[model samples]
Target: MAELLAPASCPLCLGGDNRFYHQDKVRCYWHCAHCALVFADPGSHLAADAELAIYRQHENNPQDSRYRAFLNKLAAPLSQRLGTTGLTGLDFGCGPGPTLSLMLQEAGQQMAVFDPYFANEPEVLQQQYDFICCTEAIEHFYQPAKEWALWLTLLKAGGWLGLMTKLAPTQDEFARWHYKNDPTHVCFFSRETFLFLAERDGFTVEFIGNDVILLHKKALS
Candidate 1:
């Protein structure tokens, strides 16, 4: 058996470096003592340039009606739930071109965009938002403990946080899953894992689809 290692601190909580009790061929996942987020090590990730090239292959176009319709699966419901909060939002990891922020803007919501590769605006991280969107981005988190808590801080109380990423399946299938093969994808989350996090925090969560989850602060308990 591979020896489990202790993280310097839980990636999400910063409470303390938690121990990683799980591992596989390519990665080790650490469970945060404070938050239940299991994350891969940052050192295990692909280089920034390589990660950028991978993102460049994505086709996220606001003009693409099908894609818009696909995004609406998350956008429409979240908008309906949030109503007119007048809360500005940050789209974490908005990729090379930010279509999700565009969709939110089209819905008459204000949003700031940020991505390590595409829109690396560290300044945006300073200001908080009414809500935050991390679509298809969480799986790429090499440091979930830190990034997620910061994302939580960015949202105002009672604000919504939306995410879209494929849930990790059982280990039997994960070994052969293509989603796990992406060099840029380091972290994997299951619906149960997300629900656990939300429940631990004060947020309430609604799964819009197998790939989308909408979290409202009100539900955080």
Candidate 2:
């Protein structure tokens, strides 16, 4: 029985560093003390096809005014940071319809898009960009370390990375949170968690509004 019940490793924790966080009707969660990342049990994750089915239902097209406004939360800040037009960008996870890329393009940024399910352009992943925006997508990461490494590799020196995901609420509210109810949402980040990324990985972080986070990479001298 002891052998059967091995230590459970948190997906975001490299050394399996974690503590039991919370549980709901659907799944269990783990909290990493080092980064303050709340992650779901891997056993509860949706398979690729199942996850794709859920994504397929999102109406994230260019025609949706509401979606454009939501994206503007991150885009507006990022546009201001860029300060100039014609900079290159990558919509790290543009979802099914790819509207944010279109929005930034309209703002005068050259944009490339990559979505594991919808726009799987291998070429884009091989290149670095002036900025990268990943909205409402990091929560679905099962192997967040690898993804983080990839993002760093794909960003130019002094580049900006913008993210828009609902931050994890307090432990008291964890069970009642609607964001965690989604089967695809496996990883959650707090301000502390993001700060850990910035301090450890060489970047500066700023929170915008309730959900948007901006990280600026160190520039080459």
Candidate 3:
């Protein structure tokens, strides 16, 4: 049993004493009482090359109408939240094709992008922005707390951090969840987890839909 080394900390909240939740032949999933984030054991994470290879197989493209329509789930709502045009934004984890940046640009915002594997624009990350959107990427985080901290720094005061991911299923449904079948996915977030984050980290969060989350950073006092 992998839980033999079970006294694991919640990667997102740094909460201690996470207990065993479930296990498949592949990996062990642990439940965090403090933040409600269910995550896989770090020992189960794939190597960098293996993860990158999987992502490279994706065919997402900026010109694909279906892909653009899909991204509108996050883009349209974020544009509405920004409530105006000409704002600067960053597409924090844009995968290879980079469609969201174009979508937001059409909505009248200037957009930049940074991805550790695909875009890798570290200089862009150094600049603050009015908003940042990370779609379907948070699930792959190995060090979620560090990633969250970096996003906070990249966002200007009162800025929005939009995200899209398949929120974790109820405990009963987790075993059969297709989302968990993706080997690259490590961190699983439930609505309660985001709520805990908003209260602890000083952000106001809104659940846009099943998967879209809009979190606003508190302006400095």
Candidate 4:
């Protein structure tokens, strides 16, 4: 008989230990004690082609009023912090239609967008920005640590990194949580996970809403 393997390490914080959190017919989830992030085992994540197919089916119309309102939740607050015209920002992982970038542009922020499947603009990632918005994208990260480090590098000093994703629920609630059902969503973050990241990286973190978070990079002295 083969011996059982150990639980996977936490991807976000590189914590070597984790506990089984939840499992459905399709995927198993784990909880990181060190960072409080609940995540799906990467083996269960969808292939790139399958993931792109699902993303292509999204009705991310920029003109959709309801969708615009949903994006405004992050844009409004981020713009308030930006405070002045001509600030440059990047909408990291802006999906097919990219309504959030449009909303920020109308508010006098100059914006660029990068989506691996849709926009696929490599040059955008090459430049630093005053702020970066990543709405509904962090959960899909297969390697949260690398992706986050790149985002932090692409941000100028005193820059803002805004994120919007549904936070994970209590451990007891995980078995039935709908967010875990998405095969593309490999990593999940809670408020505690964000706080852990902020403390680890020296960024000032703020929870703007139930689904929104902002991490501010301190300016160089």
Give the candidate number with the greatest lDDT. Answer: 3
Worst 10 residues of 3 by lDDT: 1-10
Candidates in order, TM-scores: namely: 0.81, 0.95, 0.96, 0.95
User: Which residue runs does candidate 4 get wrong by more than 4 Å?
Assistant: 1-8
Candidate 1 lDDT tens digits, 3-110: 655767655556574656456677765655455555666667788788788789998876888987887788888888878855698889888768889989877888
Cα lDDT of all candidates, in order?
Answer: 0.77, 0.88, 0.91, 0.87
Output the number of the TM-score-best candidate: 3
**Model 2 quality (TM-score):** 0.95
Each prediction's RMSD over C-alphas, in Å, is 3.4, 2.1, 1.2, 1.8
Each prediction's number of clashing residue pairs: 12, 0, 0, 0
Question: Which clashing pairs does model 4 show?
Answer: none
- What pairs collide in candidate 3? none
Please write out the lDDT profile of model 2 over residues 60-136, one tens digit for every residue.
77998998899999999999999999999999888888988999999999999998888998999988899999999
Better of 1 and 2 by TM-score: 2
Better of 3 and 4 by TM-score: 3
Candidate 1: how many backbone clashes? Answer: 12
Which residue runs does candidate 3 get wrong by more than 4 Å? 1-3
Q: What local lDDT score does residue 168 receive in model 2, on the 0 to 100 scale? A: 93
